[model samples]
Every structure is written in C-alpha cells, then in structure tokens.
Target: MQKDIYVVGMMVDERGSKAPDVQQVITRYGDKILCRNGIPSPSRERGIITLTMEATPEDYQRMEQDLKGLKGVTVESIHFSQPESFQLCENR
Candidate 1:
C-alpha cells in the first residue's frame, strides 16, 4: 500500500440539491476516504461551498475520477505529501 497522503480541495454548487446529497457523497466514498467536510465560505458566492477529502494515493485518484463525473462539483486543488524513507526509530 502507498503511504502517500492526498488532500483534495473541492468546490460544489450548493444550490439545487438537498442537504442529503452531502451525506451521500461521504457514504459513496466510504472507508477509502479518511476525512470529508463541507464548509461554507461567505467570501465567495453564497452557493459556493468548500469541500475537503483526504485519502491515500491510490484512493485519491479513484475518488477524483468518481467525483469529477458528478455535476456541478469542481476540484480546486490536490495536495500530495512528500515521500520519505525512514528507519525504525527507538521512540514509538
């Protein structure tokens, strides 16, 4: 399994959909998605909402593909964690 962590920033049209759609997104993504949230941003259009989801590298690509197909939602940015090699440390 890949250890890389991916954080995706998303923007969705908050109109025309019921509140349950948000929950559906989370349910669809399921276990591969570690964290998901929809945050309202007043600085922009009232209907524009910010969403964030975190996943492993493999899961990120799959999740992105799925989300991209959904209407009215746009992926703003995908942040990837740097790869690092490490030896076992004495401290746990």
Candidate 2:
C-alpha cells in the first residue's frame, strides 16, 4: 500500500455548533487517523485540532476537502510521502 504521513490542522471558529459537524467529518476518516489532539480556547468558543494520519495522498486530500467544506472551519495540511523504511531506535 502506498502510504503517506499527513499532519492536519483544523480550526473551528464556532465550536458550539460546528463541533458536531467537524466531529462527523473526523469520524468518517477514523481508520486513517493515527493520532488526534484538540485544544479548546479559554472561553471554549473555538478549538484547534491536530491530526496525524497515515493514508494515501488521495485519502488525505479527501479529508482535507471534507473539513474545508464545513462552515466556520478552516483546514490545512502538511504531507510527507513516507519513506520505504526508517529506524526508530539508535544503536546501543
């Protein structure tokens, strides 16, 4: 499978009402998401979310598009075509 790593940033301007819609979009791409982190403002009227996703380029684009389609939501992404292999540990 051709997999790329994606870092998605989402801003919810109207958290109270837009949150449910944003949640739905995120849920639709649940399997592709590796990690999610969300931060709500002090007043809780806005939220910022970051997501790490492992999926094909097409899937990432689809997700980005879905999020962008929502009202009061802004989305952006950083994509890296994952290398074939990488070492996660250093030699002892």
Candidate 3:
C-alpha cells in the first residue's frame, strides 16, 4: 500500500503550564515521528509544534485522539503524496 506524507500541527495555549505533559505525549510517539519543530509565541504563552511523520491511518488517528484529549491543546493534520516512500530500501 502507498503511504502518504502527513504533517501534524499542534498548538498549545498556556504553554508554560502544559508543556511538560505535552512533551511527554510527543515523546511517547517519537518513533513514528520523522521530524519535529516547535516555536513559542512572542509572549511565550502559546506554542506551535509541527511534526512530519509516516504512519498508517489507524496510528495517526490514535495519535490525534491522544493529543486532542489534552487540555489547552489543539491539533490539525494534512497529508499529501510524496515521490518517495518512508520505507527503507533493501540491498539487492
């Protein structure tokens, strides 16, 4: 099956209060994550995190569900085709 590239965006309000918990959740799913970038709002009260990953629909849904359960957090995701698959190539 072909896998699409998924980009997940997460926003956390009251970041100082919620960052530890949020980071824990993100760490739990670290294996599935290809790359991650996080930025804080000018006032440092809010944070935005971006993640690029490869996962099955089920896995993605599960992750999203977990994140959504967190208070003061919002999540959004977008997926699209890419020229390459996330799978590693085998030696011939």
Candidate 4:
C-alpha cells in the first residue's frame, strides 16, 4: 500500500456539544497525526482544527469516516507526495 502525507482541516459548527466528540475521534487516531492546532471562532460557537498526518490511504479513509460520523463536524484533507529531488543551492 502507498503511504501519504496529508494536511487535514476540521470544522466544528457546534463547539459546545460537538467539540468533545471531535476530540474523542482525534484521540483515537492520534498515532497517525503528526501535528495538531486548534482555534476557536470569535463568537465561540464554532472551532477550527488543523492536523498534519501520515498514513496509508486505508487508514486515512477510516479516520475520515470516524470524524465525519459526528454531527456538526466537517473534515477536509489534501495529500502531499514526496518530491523526487531537492536542490539546496538552486535558489541562490
């Protein structure tokens, strides 16, 4: 199976009740997550979270399903592929 590096964004529309559920799912898949950042909206009714993750396609879809099962939560992710080469001196 091919592995992927991803940046995921999660939105919580009803933070009061939904945030806890979101946290639970996030914790369950914490091993696949490399980094996490969360911010609350100005009104405090909603929240936004960003995650950096590395996993196989199967694992990614499973995690996505878990998060999407919660009400008022939406998940989006972008996959990043490895570069063939890096030239450090080219930018100069």
Output the number of the TM-score-best candidate. 2
> How high is the CA lDDT of each candidate model?
0.56, 0.87, 0.84, 0.84
For model 1, the stretches where C-alpha displacement exceeds 4 angstroms are 16-19, 41-54, 82-92
Model 1 C-alpha lDDT per residue in residues 1-92, reported as the tens digit of each score: 43455566666665346334644664776765555565555454424433344455666676677666667667655565645563223476
Model 4 ranges with Cα > 4 A deviation: 83-92
Kindly provide the TM-score of model 1 when superposed on the true structure, using C-alpha atoms.
0.57
Give the per-residue Cα lDDT of candidate 2 at 85.
Answer: 80
Q: Each model's number of backbone clashes?
A: 0, 0, 0, 0
Q: In model 2, state the lDDT of residue 27.
A: 97
TM-score, cand. 3: 0.80
Candidate 4 has its poorest 10 consecutive residues by lDDT at: 83-92
Who wins the lDDT comparison? Answer: 2
- Model 4 lDDT, full chain set: 0.84
Could you give candidate 2's per-residue lDDT for residues 1-92 as a string of tens digits? 67888899998998988988999999999999989999977688889999999888888888889899998999988988767585323498
Give the C-alpha miss distance for residue 66 in model 1, angstroms.
Answer: 1.3
Worst 10 residues of 1 by lDDT: 44-53
List residue ranges in candidate 3 displaced over 4 A.
1-3, 81-92
- Flag regions of model 2 displaced more than 4 Å: 85-92
Per-residue CA lDDT of model 3 for 16-91, tens digit only, reads 8898888998888888888999997668889999999776677778888889999999999998665554444457
